[model samples]
Target: MSVFTAVTEDDLARWLGDYAVGRLVSFEGIAAGVQNSNFFVTTTLGRYVLTLFETVARADLPYYLHLTAHLAHHGLPVPAPVADRNNEYLGTLSGRPAALVRRLSGRWLTDPTPAHCTRVGAMLAGLHLAGQSYGRRQPHPRGAQWRAEVAERVLPHVGAEDAELLRTELAWQAQQDFDALPQGVIHADLFRDNVLWDGELIGGVIDFYFAGTDTLLFDLAVTVNDWCTMADGSLDAARSAALLEAYGDERAYTEHERRLWPAALRAAALRFWLSRIEDLHLPRSGEMVQVKDPNEYRRILVARIDGEARLPDRP
Candidate 1:
């Protein structure tokens, strides 16, 4: 389950009717994601993941479907979408596009250690290397583009006392001179919940809704912040090292990328802060959802930039 929502057996049966793979016997809501409603469906034949689109643009799905197929073809650990009887991978359900994916058999670790971080880091590197050859794809604009929403939607919702701090930081960041890092197809969001584990090993990755064309190092920086940023808003050096080393082993960082790490980390944190704040103010009904605290990421970013936190070594 990816989101905190409900899915009934009848809903699954109706959705699975178009598919020839199996007859749906049971279904359950998946509670791990915050974007769309998800269900773990079991059939006479096998298990599959059924997602009911919430706020996602149907136009944006081709990138996810094609990207997952491309990575799977390259032997990376990604879920493959199953086709219906008409050979279509996407189908309409309750006025939304839905798809059934082969269920990856694994458990999501509630508490991930450094070892899990290392494996996930390696998996991310392999996923990126395999996707380097994929056809060009673009990110869909957030319901509001990052800039306008950050200043308008997000700022108005934050408490007045904390608003000035974010405002100051945002203003400073906007004026900073920085170089554009390397560009590629990037999995911009790689949270631990998106990774599936079997015992102590990483089984596979899921959720490609945030995949897009962006600075490659920027994507790595996002992963670092999500997987290695600590509860106290500091970098977990040991975990960060494991992930960065794993990523560097696949595609060694250029001197430019190395130099941009600090800035990129801050930028990534700001991006999530804006997105989470936006979501908090505009909650969607019937969508499996949660409100993330943007302040946590902001604290981590400030600490890193202020030299109070240690950064991972450059390779």
Candidate 2:
């Protein structure tokens, strides 16, 4: 129930006239995401998801929409934007930039198997390969520079132990040679919920808002941290192995990426931990919102720091 903007039936019906999506049969606010105002829109033609960008700048939106369209065109399972008569993928509704995309089938798997991880790994590599010629360049918004800035902002609110840990981790990450690793467009946030599954196959990889240019290993780190973790925040060795092996089959990991894998995992955990803490103390308002527990990533970060979870050796 994270719909921040309300769209009345009359307003939506009028909006539908611009696109050839047929008459509006029904529409309701989607409750899953925390960023945009999403609705499950049904029309006489097909089912689609309409999203109203809330925090995203109107000018910066073309990168996301066009990236999605490009990925879909390159045979990846992504939500392609539904264009209006003018061949424009973006429009305005409820005083916010909006766009419609075909709704994908299947549900997110809460309890994922190694097979599922394998599928995600392969598809992620495919996504990176597909974006080799994407043209547009958007740096990772939550990269090291932003993380350092936000750490100072959130330090005053956290406990002394947490603050010290944050400083140490950030300083260590800053010293790493991430430039040597392979670089490409990455889904910076590839949490389980963002991926849709039809049985063991990935129906689609949704939520491209956080995507940007970064080391390929960082992207893999983000995926493994969430998708390959057990309940106790420990990395599941089998699942991690499956993911890395499958990913390597598509795009072989460079020796540099392999060497920096551990640091990348640490960086991924720290990124989420800092962002979650900020979200908890400095909150944002939305029509319907749910704040995730910062402690979850804190536990994952601590585990990574303790050298308890290591990715399986490159196959």
Candidate 3:
């Protein structure tokens, strides 16, 4: 996470007064991501991740914080947001809307095996299942509308070939009836880096800022695109099967979902490609900011259009 808002030790020590998590022991900025300002906060009681919202508005904060709490309450391995003395999960620190959640154990896997993919698939299905009862309803921040807008915004910054691809894909996706598919709250950005693993088990899932109401199949497609893809942007069959099979065990996919799997994969790839291009061309100024290559997802979008991936059969 980028450090958009820098907080001094003195600043954090004072902010800790409103919480019951004891005195602040130490705090450091997280530098891996480019979205929010994140810090590894250590207090006398335990470890927590403090996030200062950068793009997310203060009013829309409750939907994310409460969503995590809701998932944690349902026995998922999500980090529970810590409520302050005032019984609120959100707080203001350093003039930015912020939140703190108990940091769970383990690290995100960089090179995940099929077994790992299986666990992620199962957990994702469980997440969608648990989200059925969530009280809040927010449209996915990077859903269809955002895709069209962002693709248009970034087209002028790219070459002619990429611009044509964007236009073609945008038109194709517009004709899709994703709203007709099974819908619910989805973890729209369930990439490999977001899931922490403790040995054979998934320790925790983080970064719920992108979670919202969307097609459950689209969510699965997003995960598959990240966790099951290869260096050349091709899908690895073993990992794909492991993940989709495990997911189907929990909530079986309908025939309609199966029929639309290829299009959904293209939709997922296009969204991330648009986002990466936007980040690369129209980036925000922040401490330790990282902008990933837009070309990686660009290759994936092309590969998906070539029809290289499909829902794998269960063993």
Candidate 4:
């Protein structure tokens, strides 16, 4: 999350009174992502992550926060939302919905190896399995409908060739069917930045705001698009193979899922491309908002369509 909304130390201290998280020793605005306002909060007792929801509806917060708790209860490395003295996981701070999660150890990787991909894949598989019982049903926000809407909003601002590509890709995505594929809760944004690493092991996974009910394969595709892609946005065979095989070892891939892997990869790429384009064309004012390059995912979409992205042969 980004620093769209400013949370002054005094503002945070007043909010801290609602929780038993100890006195706020210090806090600072986090300046990385684009969805919400985030800060690193340190207290005498412990450290925590403070988040202020920007665009998410208030009622919808529980589905995401509770799903994180559910995964945590299942022994996943997700950060569980910390409840206040009233045992509430959500509150209002600086006129926005706010939350606290115990700060987790480890740092995110900039350049992950095949071994790292293997660990991420296994953890993702475990997440899918554990998510089966969450029993909540929030639709994936970046589905086909959202793609079309975002594409419509962004098309006029792009070049003719790029616009044509977006149109054709959206049509291709609409024709696909995932009814036969395994479906469950998915971390719709499991990019490298969302995961924390301690040595060779995964120590933490954050940013569950994008988690939702969707094809599990789509989740895997999203991870692969970010974690296993080269500078030109083509998949690295060794890294992708390590990840796919590791995931398959934990949870077998269905024949249908296997057949649709390439399409899933393309779909995942398009999702990010559309969002990035929107962010670039229709940016909002914020303190630490990162407006990413839409072309990054555009290259990925092209690579997937060119067959550079392939799921490993199922064992």
- Residue 188 of model 2: what lDDT? 93
lDDT of 3 by residue, 1-315 (tens): 889899999988998889999999999999988789999999999899999999998999999999999999999999899998999999999899989999998899878899999999999999999999999999899899899888878989999999999999889988878878999999999999999988889999999899899999999999999999999998888899999999999988887788789999999999888888998999999878989888898888898888655665542
C-alpha lDDT (0 to 100) for residue 267 of candidate 2: 94
lDDT by residue (tens digit), candidate 1, 179-248: 3666777777788778888888777788888788777777787888888877776777788888888778
- Which candidate, 1 or 2, would have the higher TM-score against the true structure? 2
Candidate 4 local lDDT, residue 245:
93
**What is the alpha-carbon lDDT for the whole of candidate 2?**
0.88
Clashes of 3: 1
Candidate 4: C-alpha lDDT: 0.91
Higher-ranked by lDDT: 1 or 4: 4
Clashing pairs in 1: 1-30, 2-32, 2-33, 3-33
Off by over 4 Å in 3: 313-315
Predicted candidate 4 versus true structure: per-residue lDDT over 1-315, tens digit per residue: 789888888888888988887898998888888899999999878999999999999999999989989999999998899999899999999899999998888999899999999999999999999998988899887877788999999999999999999999988888888767898999999999999988778999999998888899999999999999999989988999999999999999888888899899999999999999999999889989998999999999998999745566766
Off by over 4 Å in 4: none
What are the models' TM-scores?
A: 0.90, 0.96, 0.98, 0.98
What are the clashing pairs of model 3?
A: 1-33
Error of 1 at 124 (Å): 1.3
Score residue 205 of candidate 1 by CA lDDT.
Answer: 82
